[model samples]
Target: NGVMNLSIKDIQGEMLIVSQFTLQAKTAKGNRPSYIKAAKPDISVPLYEAFCKSMETHLEKEVKTGVFGADMQVALINDGPVTIWMDSKEKDY
Candidate 1:
């Protein structure tokens, strides 16, 4: 609940919440990435749904989401070359 919510609200933006477990991949070892830190489907599914619901509540609009634990393809045109990443575990940022 901060700038992200404000920016989206100001722009009347719609959000697509995708459950990308790969974001938690650990790559310090070999060529293959490890998803050991990612939560299992049984745990993540509920959390994902809850997150979408929370966002909808805060945004006062319907939020779209992808199917959890499913192999899906996403397509989006990059508005600009910039990308930002944030992690809940790294709250100091």
Candidate 2:
């Protein structure tokens, strides 16, 4: 994965993984969104932990993560104005 090519350890960078079920939410009908595609806790929790562990293994450093199914507040300060989006299926970024 080109995104992972960067040496985060060398740069002393920190990572945060948030369980964003809204990514799978469907908003086709009305104002309310449906979460039919999002995995239930039984499925998503293990996968999410596996992902965080994988990141830690790859980076050789601890990776931070948010609560799996909690209402939480997040504050982020943009170090730069650039934003890049990548899709695994496309892999064209």
Candidate 3:
């Protein structure tokens, strides 16, 4: 079997951690997405923070993050196959 087993430690690039609370959205009832199942920020914030901290520990470096609970706009230019490298030296907007 030509299966490639990879780990986060093997990634030689920066990690961007975004908190997507919409993952818990329930759309079974109606067209509008209901976030009733989502954890409130009071609970989710700590979990999100913990996850980013854990990832930083695993990668042995500080991970980049977006503003929590803010309406943010992200633009991505995915050039190659699954990997997009951004120069970390650039200051975060």
Compute each candidate's TM-score over C-alphas. 0.80, 0.81, 0.73
**Candidate 2 backbone clash number:** 0
- Candidates in order have lDDT scores of 0.84, 0.86, 0.80
Please write out the lDDT profile of model 2 over residues 1-93, one tens digit for every residue. 564565667678888889988988899999999999999999999999999999999888899899999888988876557577656685543
Better of 1 and 2 by lDDT: 2
Residue 20 error, candidate 2, Å: 0.9
Q: Model 3, 1-93: lDDT tens per residue?
A: 523355557757677888777867888988999998889889999999999999998899999998889888876654234654556476857
Clashing pairs in 3: none
What are the root-mean-square deviations of the candidates from the true structure over C-alphas? Answer: 4.0, 4.1, 10.9
> How many residue pairs clash in all the candidates, one count each?
0, 0, 0
Per-residue lDDT, model 2, residue 31, is: 90
lDDT of candidate model 2 versus the reference: 0.86
Misplaced by over 4 Å in model 2 are 1-7, 90-93
Instruction: List model 1 lDDT by residue over 10-75, tens digit each.
Output: 888888888898888999998899999899888988899999999999899999888887899998
